[model samples]
Target chain A: MNKRDIALIIIILIIAVLSYCIMNISSDKDGDMVLVTVDGKSYGTYKLHEDREFEIQNEYGYNIISIHDGEVCIKDADCPDKYCVKQGKISKNNESIICLPHKLVIETVRTMDDGGAGDIDSVAK
Target chain B: MSKHVAKLGIFIALAMIFSYIEVLIPFSFGIPGVKLGIANIVVVTGLYILKPQEVFVISVLRILLMGFLFGNMLTLVYSLAGGILSFVVMLVFKKITLFSIIGVSAAGGVFHNFGQILMAAFILHNEKIMYYFPVLLVAGVITGILIGFLSDNIIKALKHYN
Candidate 1:
């Protein structure tokens, strides 16, 4: 490869590293709440410390969300690939379990009153 | 003209096989949207051996066929987005002539992940999807470099055999 090509690759990698660090830094907040959404609309907010199982039915299918012992995860999902279920448990701020086909999102947030901190900011499923 | 079509068909078939092999292998790096992109080898090789039109046809056909065989509607959309973006980026890099085969393929890999994430963001209407960008970026570079190195060698072998 020429100098320019090498430079381009290096620049991309540097940006990647920087962005990763920034994302991690922002996600480090001590989260105490879980927010759920379907099709870009808010479903409800649940306390992370509570233990419960709830199903969200939408146009695509259903996702069974489980909140247990201060963490939340997809207990099961009817969507193909079971990617959301495979996401395991999430308790940290900005951590999310997404089911793209069902347009479902579950994220952990520090506060439920911020009105913006956990408003389905990202889809990482 | 028939001969050209036949050649494209063969290339597309080969690409499909690569795609199938990837499916059979349980190769997940624990990150969404990251892949080895083995099928990309065919597209990268075609960039040098086939005309631009032929390259596009082969790549798109391969993606469509693969989706039909092993993927759902969502998978098809993501693949189409990634494939088209990667192809376009590779073409631009090839035209630049400053990059070697490997460099071009690297660009293709990076852009492929970018296109998929962009599509995800649009569909979900969540900018948070971009949070996965950096991780996908690194995965793209690693896979792109691997695919580029393999394509470079494969092309050399084809030239020798020819």
Candidate 2:
């Protein structure tokens, strides 16, 4: 490896570090709700504080999501990869579990009000 | 001309074998989309021995054949995006002539992940998938370095044949 090679490696490392720091900074806010989207359309939004199991069945497949004690996880899924279930739990804002095969995304969000009117209102509109 | 074609065929076979080896290893870090990218060794070495277009052809053929045999259509799409982007970036880096083969291969690795993530985010219509970028970036650089090192040695050993 020459000087340029070392420089290129350092640049890539710096970019990775910067992105990691940015993700952490943006996700510092704790989320109180989980938003599920199928094929970019909102399926439902559930309160993180509630312990419940929600099953989503669509043309692509099915996934069972469980929220317990402010944490959200995919309890089960029929997607071939099972990557969403393997992703474990997430509670931080912007953190998410993605099921690519089904085009499903479950992400945490911070609602603007105590009643989560902001998310509902946006969804309604 | 026949000699060149024969050499390209050999590289393609070598790349396919590497892909097969990668599949058999079960080398998953559990992050999804992360792999050793061992087949890239052939791509990096090809950059030195073959024309840019020839290397591109080999890369595409390998992805298509391997994708059909071991992966699905979605994987084929991902591999095409990654492989094409990687080849372009590697070509540019190699053209500059300032960096060694290692740097060129490293750039290829990094861009390959970038392309795949971009495609995933677009297809999923969820920008949140960008969260995987940092981890993928680090993984790309590490694998790129290893592949680059191997390619450097291979190029040196094959200097007489070239």
**Candidate 1 stretches greater than 4 Å from native:** A112-125
DockQ of each: 0.62, 0.79
Best by lDDT: 2
lDDT tens digits, residues B40-155, model 1? 99999999998988899889999988898888888899889999999999999999898888789888999999999898878787777788899888889888989989998899
For candidate 2, write residues B1-162 as lDDT tens digits: 897788889999999999999988957866777888999999999999888899999999999999999888888888999999999999999998988988898889999999998998888888889999999998898888889999999999998765
lDDT of 1: 0.85
Candidate 2, A1-125: lDDT as tens digits: 98989999999999999999988875777888888988888888888899999889988889999999999999999987788899999998778999988889998877755536765564333
Candidate 2: segments with Cα more than 4 A from true spot = A113-125, B160-162
- Model 2, position A91, has a per-residue lDDT of 96
- Cα RMSD (angstroms) for every candidate in the order listed: 3.0, 2.5
